[model samples]
Target: MVEEAPYRRIAAEIRERIARGDLAPGDRIPSTREITRDWGVAMATATKVINALREAGLVETRSGAGSVVIDRSSPQVEVVIQPDVPAHAGGFHVAASPRLRRAGEPELNRDRVVSSAVAIADAEGLSMLTMRRVAADLGVATMSLYRHVPSKEELILAMIDAVFGENPLPEEPPADWRARLETAARQMWQSFAAHPWAAEPLSLTRPQLLPNVLPYSEWSLGTLRELGFGVDEMMHIHLSLFGHVRASALNLDAELRAREDTGVTNDEWADQHGDELEAVLSAAAERFSALRYVAERGFDYDIAAVFESGLRLLLDGVAVALARREVSGDEQVDLSVV
Candidate 1:
C-alpha cells in the first residue's frame, strides 16, 4: 500500500525498458544529469537510480561515459530476477557467476581479472574503477575478484604491469644509441597514449617495479652508459626523459574529462570562444604582443605534436651535453648543435 521510493520507481522503469529491448546490452543508459533533468529529481536521487541498476546487474558505469547495459546473453554468465515480484518491489535475485566451472566453461584467473580491470580503466578513468565494477564487467560477483586480486591497490599494480608488457622491448634493440633511446621513448609514449590513465599512478618517487618497465630503464640507462656517462648522469637522463613523457601523457586524461564534461572538442571550444579570446588579446595588444600574434595567426593545439617536440628538444640537449663531454673533457658544447 506504500508508495515506492523514487529511485526504485526509476530503476523499475529502466528495467522494463531493458526487458522490452528498448535498451540493449552495451547501450548507455541515462546519466545522472540526464536522469535528474528528465525525472525532475535531485542529483542524489538520480545517483541512487544508477546504483540500484548497477546493483541489480542491469548496468555498468563507465567513467566519463554514462552507465551502459551489460550483456547478459552469454551462456557463461547468467542473471535471474525473482519471478512474480512487483516492479516496485526493488529486490533482485542474482546467482554469482562461478569462478571455476566445467572444462569448457570460462574460468576466472589472475589474467582475466587484471585484463578486465585494465579495459575498464582504459575506457573510464581510474576513478571509475572498482572491484564491483570489474566483477560486473566479467559477470562475476565482486567478492570473487578478491580471491584472485588481493586488493584494489594490488589490482592497479597488476594492471600497470600488464599494459607495460604489451609493448615488450625488442630482444635486439637498435644498434645506434640515438635510435635505441628514441625507440624506448616512443614505446613508453605509445603505451601512455593508448592508456591515458596510466601516467599518474606510475609515480617517479615511488616507481612501481614492473617487470616490463625495468627493461626499458635498463635499456635507456645502458644507452647513456655506452656514451661514457657515469651512472649518476645516466640515471638523471633516464628520469628526465621519463618525466617529459609522463608530464605530457597526463594531459590526455585531463583533456578527455574536459571534453566529456563540456561535450565539445578542443577546436570546437576554441571556435566558440574565438571572439572573446581575440578581444582579450586585443585589449592588451602592446603588453601581450607575442600572445596576440599567435592568437591572430590561429594556433592549433595538439597534444601529440607538443609531446614530440618536447621529446626531441630534451634528447637534443642530452646529445649536446654528450658532445661537450667528449670534446673538452670540460669544454661546453655549442647549443647550436641541437
Candidate 2:
C-alpha cells in the first residue's frame, strides 16, 4: 500500500545511501520537509519513516547534525531471545535457559540477566560483554539493564560467580595437603579453560572474595596448619602460592587468542623480527647512551612454554617449603624465592 510504503521502502533507501557512501556517520538524513518534498509523501508519513529509523537504531539527532546516520562501525549489540514456555515448565520449575526482559513486560530477575550475559561472554570473549550487547540479548532497552545491575562492573562480577558456580568442587578431602592443593589447582585451571572470560575479572593481589574461592584458600591454610605451621606462616605460603598459580594460568586463554589473532607462528615471528629487535637495541644504545651499561637478559619466552614451566616451578617451590618447615633445627627455614 502507498500509505505504508514510505516506512517500508525508505529504510532500504537509507541503507543504500549508507552503502554507497552518499551518507555516512554524523551526516544528516533528509529532514521531514525534504522527505515530504522528495518522496512526495504526507507530513505524517515522513514522521513515521523517521520514527521507524530511530526505533531501528539507524539514526539519531545531534544538535548540529540533525537526524544523522548511526555509526555502523560501532560494535554490534544484541539482546537475548527469551526461552519459550514448554508444555511442562511450571512456575516452580527452574528454567534451563535465560529469560529475556522486554520493555513494558515484567522486569526480568537478576539471575536470568546474569546467566544470559555469562553465556554470551563464554561463547565470544570478554570484550564482547557490553551493556548494549547484553541488553540486545535480553530484547530490552540498553538502559533497562541498569535497573538490574547498577553498573557493568557489577554485571561482570555476577557473570564470574554464575559461571564459577556451575562446576562445583568435590566434597571429600584428600590424604595430604599437597594432594588437596593439587586437586584444587587442577579444578581451578579446568574451570578457567571452560570460560576464557573468567581471567579478566580476577585480580592477583586484590581478588574479590567470592565465597566459592575462599573455601579453596581456607583448605590451603588448613592443610598448612595440619602440617604444624603457625597461622602467620600458613598465610604467607598459601597467599604466595595462590598468587603464583594465578600469574601462571590466569592469562593462558588470552595469550592463545592473541596468537590466533596475529596469525603468525611464534617461532616465525622471532625468526623474521630477530634482526629488527637487535637493530632497535643498537639504536637505543646509540641514541639514549644509558642502555649499553646494563646487561640484557637475552631471553624471549614463548608464552605457552612459560605457562607450563611456571606451574611446575610453583609446585616445586611449595614442595621445598613443606620439607624445610618440617626440618627439626632449620633455624626458621628461609624459604623465600624457593
Candidate 3:
C-alpha cells in the first residue's frame, strides 16, 4: 500500500476521534498552533490537516472557535432536481451544474488571481483561503494558479500589499506630531478593520519587509524625528502605535469566526454564557471581590470605543514623557536594558 502523507495521517487521527464521539459536534478541534505543539509539525502541515477535515465535511471553520465538528443532526434544506424532469413536478427545482469558465470570459492573469484571492480572504478568514479554493472561485484549474502566483506565501504577501495600497497617506502631514501619529494610528486601525485577516501575519518582533507597510513606519518615524526624538525613541513610538492597532484588530478574525460558527455576536455570546460565568464568578467571589462586583454591574465592552479611549491615554502619557524630556534637557537614556 502507498504510504499516506503526514497531513493525511494527522487528519485521520482527528477523524477517528470524531467518529468515536471524542470530538462531539460544536466541539473545537486542535488549532494550527495547538497541532504544531502537539504533533511537532509545521504550521503548513497543520493547516493542511484542518483543510482536509473541512473538505470532508467533518469540521468547519468558525471565526472565533477555529475548527469545530459540524452538527450533522441539524436539518438541511437542499434543492433536489431530477434531470430531464418537468420543473412544475418538482416545484421549480434547479439542476446542479458544474462551475466552469464560460466562453469569452476574461483572460486569467496574475492581477485577476491576486484580486480573487483577496476577495476570498476578505469574505472568509485567511484560514479558509487556499490555492484550490481560489481557483474554484476564479473558475480555473488549481495548477493554472501556479502559473500566476508561485506559492501561498507570495500570494499572501501580494494580498497584504494590495490591502495596504488601499489607504494612502496624505501628501501634507498634520501640523503637530501627535496629530500626525494619531491620524496614522487611526488609519491603520481602519485598514485592519476592513481586512481583518490581514492583521494575522503582521508581527512586531520579526516584521514583514513589504514596501507599502514600510511607508507607515517611515511616516511615523519622520513625524517623531521632527519632534527631536532620538532613533530608539522614534522606533519605540512607531512600533507602540502599530502594535496597539494590530493587537486590537487581531480579535476581528476570531470574532468574525465565532460569529459564523455560533451565529452569535460578542455581546450575544456573553449573554448566552452569562449564567455559567456568574456561577463560576460567584464561587470565587470571596477571593475576587472586584471582579465579582464588576461582573454584577455589567460592563458594556465596545472594542472600538475602548481603542479610542486607550489611544488618548497612551498619547497623553507619551506627551507627558516628551514634555519631561524637553524640560530636563537630558540625553536619551538606554531603554534596551529592560
Which candidate wins on TM-score?
1
Q: Which residue pairs show collisions in model 3?
A: 62-257, 63-257, 63-258, 64-257, 64-258
**What tens digits encode model 1's per-residue C-alpha lDDT throughout 78-139?**
55443332343333334531221223546889998987788767755677577876775665
**What's the residue-level lDDT of 78 in candidate 2?**
26
Candidate 1: residue pairs that collide: none
Model 3 bad stretches (over 4 Å) = 1-105, 331-338
Task: Quote model 2's TM-score.
Answer: 0.56
With candidate 1 superimposed using the best TM-score fit, by how many Å does residue 53's alpha carbon deviate from the native?
3.8
Model 3 TM-score, all chains together: 0.69
lDDT per residue for candidate 3 within 1-338, as digits (tens), equals: 98767787888889889989999998988876567767888868877776556545566544445567777555541222224432221111123212323235568898888887787677557886889767645545689999989999989988888888889778798777778889888888888888889998887999888888888888899877766678898888888888888888887678876666556899988899999989988888888888889888998878788778878887887787677676687545232211
Ten-residue segment with the worst summed lDDT in candidate 3? 88-97
TM-score of each: 0.79, 0.56, 0.69
